[model samples]
Target: MPIVARANLSPASREEHLARLESATLEYPLDVLVIGGGATGAGAAFDAASRGLDVGLVEAGDLASGTSSRSSKLIHGGLRYLQMLDFTLVAEALRERDLLLTRTAPHLVRPVSFVFPFARKVIDRVFIGSGVALYDTLQSLGRRRAVPLHRHLLHDKLMTVFPALDGSKLAGAVEYHDAQVDDARLVMMLARSAALHDAAIATYTRVIDYVREDGRVIGVKARDEETGHEFVIHAREIILATGVWTQEQQEIAEAETGLRVLASKGIHITVPKDRIPAKAATGIITQTEKSVLFLIPSDEYWIIGTTDTPWTEDVAHPAATAADIEYVLDHANEILASDLTREDVIGVYAGLRPLLQPVSKGEKAASASTKVSREHTVMTIEPGLTAVAGGKLTTYRVMAEDVVDHAIRDSFPDRPSLTASLPIVGAQGYRELTAQRSEIARIREYDLVRVDRLLGRYGALLPEVMALIDTDPSLGEPLEGDERYLRAEVVYAVRAEGARHVADVLMRRTRSDYEVADRGAGAAAEVAALMAPELGWDAEREALEAETYRAHIAARLAGEQARDDASAAAALADAPEVPRRA
Candidate 1:
């Protein structure tokens, strides 16, 4: 039988989690308290909870609202790290990648082939080809290969593979495989799995300061960002997984020394897939002056981006400037049959990478932000407080295990982490359920295309969505003004996925915000109406939620008009926030 995991998160669960924190004290404290709700933090909660530890996690915003959601959404062995000669990182990441594709999240992650167009004939093939060969070799070392091996394509074959290429500037191409994932969904699933293991999970709860003992960290003073209610959470050990905010969090704990983390900004723009014709290709990547440019596929649209530069502005609201958008378009147009203009862009987003500096060498080792390693670092900020930062989405599991291991090394010395072998909430029966997709759609009276899409998102738990439809047949209809998503999805985001605001349901729970031209503004009122009754919001509150969603989108659109990071961030500052639910 598949592992039984049917957990749900709602406002009631949030209240329960908060009560657990409020009731715990010195005599009865949680074994581990995790701060941050991004990928690594959620993973740490899963790791600790699975090991039979009393775990409690708190987040300042919705899950994956930070760097976790803003990723390129690719899960690979860090193909770029091979050039840096980080063989161990590549090999370890490859193992994890295979695990996700096969064992853990077969539904959310799938292999994507990328063709690297050759600029020079011999030198490019010999150098880049050998590097790709090594990338495959490392994957072969794992128990099983998640994706296929690399292949070299001649002129005719390369053109057949990717017809969009200009063909005039390229000699040939080499194709290799990597995986893409639903970044925010993965984090949410991880949190749900942890909750199933008896972990107390809370979001929109910010840790204000450390509750310390005689020169040792013991607990935290926190506030409910949604209600402004202050409380204390007592824990034996506190794990800080606050990516770019690591230093800021350390200051709150009043630690003597901590890991020095620098913020590197990366941005992505979405465009209609038909704009760039690729008859036989999933995507393509090419070398850029600063970083490698990727044209990855995501559903109906293509996600193309990634400008890696130093970010000295706000970490909370990273926005893509006009210059950043122009840089991506120019690079993408370099090899495309037709040049892309600003009108081709459907949406844009910017996220910060926690570029961790080497703890051994201190903070001044690297001058360029691009030169910094994407690897993670875990340090004992003090006696009982530990902080971890850096590392990409591909290696979040490893980072989680490492952080949890640090938390329990002295306390639960005999316990071991069960995450590597344990499947997440929706992974166990996912394949079987997928085989029954047509039957599922037939019984539920859903479109075949709609069922297929939801399966990719929910896996074995697709039935849970069906159950929602059974209770309220109206939810089975397409989301108002956004036919791409079902109304049930919005309701699920609240009743099961812990979405509190309209933005939470529209943006993170579903991709309606970025996948659409208006960024889901047209659907804001409808989405708010679906969530209002579930969240106990009055008519005025529902209107406020809808307006806040629209205002935030306006702020992002205004930010996109800026040419620099400072101005873009300033524009984003005008974005209205979700009001406290007191």
Candidate 2:
């Protein structure tokens, strides 16, 4: 019965959040407070809120600005995990994958098929066939039976489905179904949905210290990164889901209770659609050397090359080197008929993964990034603080539920999780709404693809986007350089999505920065100018935003030329700097 909408994140909303915090501090001492704004944190907030617990979520930066935004964006039951013979892990992830595609967020997650091209003639088809079969079996055990099972492809049919493949080397391929999602948008929506359930959600707010009493963790001493104001709000419990930054949080918690976290970095590159022929399909390819490669199709470009390397420098922005790019291109090119080079690459991003560590000897030489682990661990280092680590994006819900369960097992004796049946904000009537997508296009005065795409990302919330177009018809026009996105989305990002700067609008809200060839430079100034009035910026602010975005683009370009992290980070030294746009 405590549903709130459109949180009024206006100046008024900030005051309301503070007032709520103060009020809740005085009443019942609150239930749970979550830290970090990535996928797991957002997931934890939703889980706790749905369970009828008083919850507050604090993020030092924008939601999903870290590794969550830098993911492969696939929501599949990791097929490779099946090879590891981890059935329990595969089953749980598949269940969540089904929930996202069918019920929890039908509009945000969509089914995508991948083709695993078999190149060796001596390799038994049954060996690869059995793995695909197990992957399909896991899908049936999930809540939604929407995705179809894997099918064997004949040599002729495989070539037909992917005309670009060099059939001389390829024996045949297997086609299987998985799902893809807009990872950043999903986290933002989860935070918004948790807010609707009365969870306190604030971005650009950092927890500087944990306030402890005697031996129990009580609350936190935090500062608004934007305004530099410090405040305290005592709570019954805390949950940390900071992703790669998990170790830093543990250090802070360790000050009081001694816990540790390890960081692993994963880097991904984006190339033009033309670089990879359309027939490659969006699926995982296991190289002869045992390394896995993902050829994913994004809205406007093909995403390729993800190097798993240990990282120890510049955690804020992981830099991709020339060597990293070469390694990826070298492996991926082995299968393609038309080879790709440096010119085809458009964007590159890297993120750190937080893996639980026992501090192995020679950990540095272990290997490339460990295959993404399906299992997650939750630890209560002290009386009121809980830390979770080592989970994939697909299984965030289960991780969240477990974290909350550990946090409140003693405090909230009567509460049970309601998130399993709870629908995210845009999920209401999603099927029926999709059924009316054609009609909605008529009423919204947009093409069927545009309307459906918007609906797909925002779910029942397409009305919010359409309402902006209604106010200014010009807002419906596509962005200056990117036709796949509409100009009106810029206005919506600031007004409703908590996008504070141009980078937020380009990099996350729209993804035009990585998807477009020019890295969204052509549209940056126009978008900044349009958002100025809404975000309360002057001419100087607009100019600053434009410069900052241009620098981001240049740094990424320069990063490609460097052979290692030192040169890569140095290349970005003069690229341009802006306030962190949360």
Candidate 3:
């Protein structure tokens, strides 16, 4: 089969994908049916399709709406994992990280430096420095070193590197490199690449049940959440990449024997970049009572997080409690020149990591989720059903390869994974476009900074977005509430990026939600009005969409104020749910 170039995920493409889903087995069954739209699922779809396998992927919500979008956004070899002495896992992740930075998605992934601050001089320096040296060594084992090696800095130099640090501590620091990315965009690019390879990709499509015959799973019964239409998609093999919802899916399928997945809720708070007086993308690794915490720096914000506590709340909306916020703020403030309070936080987001339930019995069973292995497991639950769980974002490509290779082991025994060599949708000519960024900016009459931002987000696909601007000069204007985003990007989200809801554009397609103080509430109405026509929403529907988004933001803020998870859940429950299409 020849590769086709209709890679756009416009409304028309979604309709086409839905039409194909309705007629899946009637025409012919797919070789593989993937259930998830996260990094793992998208990667699997692209991997399977690239190898000439007929595949279809379904997600109950927007692509990367779950944990994939809420990550700390680093692609590292897991320095903490090295403390556990997991050499193989670290090497594999480093290899995948290098592939992404250099070959697969250079535009989405870039090199970032982190400062490992040390308070206890000599002992701390040797301990952290040795681990970082090992990390650099493993990265060098890859085909190319995508980032720089680790360097040692004394207390004075460390203070120079991060002026935000408290001089009272007056300790040395180790600077090391890791790759960071827009996690949601990476998943979106994967799905688009899969669609370009002829894979049927459908979002807001929920798998209600499994299609079973003679005790062997054969396909899935899915519901199109957009139109409330139910359909059966037959496939020779089914791969379940659902993360935190894996256990729920297992129950729906009535799979008595399979890997059990536990959900560990992690939350991150975003503060304005100016609050952190840092010239570079700096991160600090500190030990929490339960697990380690990370304070990673992004372009215009500092993402401070992550409390690893067990969660037993609604999976869709994991609320971040006052305790969670305080935990992060307290630890993060420990090393800062100025303290960060709840008032300083502009945005907060929570995600659940789908950890595999450890096989330990009795008292050992009470181990913290952090102690659970980060390695992924592939299990053939039944004749035609396969499921994968417990891997990090950096190694998603390898996880996809493992799942696909296992699913097709009997059918296509000789076929090997080709994703390592395949550049995702926007990566093909990215370098050339980046080199010509100044020329493109001159021709388009935009500033060099604007063009550079576009290249960072779109890469070779920049022309496609520029075409939207050319069609409507108004699109070239900045969004009303947030000057960092262009109006054209909003239209592009709906017209080309498979964005079906107002929240999708605000939260994922653009960083308006977390970047601004109002949590995107200020831009809600404008965005809804812009998307109304394309999504076929009437005035009332548009109003409802805008109102629902505001409620969501309000609820999230209220949740953050609540003292505990239960109270946070109640506060989050205040948000009126967006009515799905019937």
lDDT of 3: 0.87
Give the runs in model 2 whose Cα sits over 4 Å from its true position.
1-4, 7-12, 22-28, 142-144, 256-259, 279-284, 288-290, 358-368, 371-374, 443-445, 571-577, 580-582
Instruction: Give Cα distance to truth, residue 317, candidate 3, Å.
Output: 1.7
Best-fitting candidate, scored by lDDT: 1
Cα lDDT tens digits, model 1, 1-582, are 122433577788889889998887989999999999999999999999999999999999899989999889899998888999999999988988888998988888888999988979899999989999999999997366768889998878888878888999899989999999989999999999998888888999999988878999899999998778999989999999999999899888878899888888999999998998887547898879899899998788899988998888878878889999999999999999889999989988889999986545343555578888877888898988888998889899999999989977999988898888898888989999989989988887877888878998999888888888889999989977678888998888898788998988878888777789999999999999999999998999999999988988898988899888998898777775465465
lDDT of 2 by residue, 401-449 (tens): 9999988999886787777777888888678778898898888676887
Question: What lDDT does candidate 2 reach at residue 59?
Answer: 86
Local accuracy of candidate 3 as per-residue lDDT tens digits, 362-391: 334545788788899999988899999999
TM-score of 1: 0.97
Q: Which parts of model 1 are misplaced by more than 4 Å?
A: 1-6, 358-367, 580-582
How much lDDT does each candidate structure score? 0.88, 0.77, 0.87
TM-scores for every candidate against the unseen true structure: 0.97, 0.93, 0.97
Please say which candidate is ahead in TM-score: 1 or 2: 1
Query: Each candidate's root-mean-square deviation in Å?
Result: 1.9, 2.7, 1.8
Among all windows of 10 consecutive residues in model 2, the one with the lowest summed lDDT is 1-10
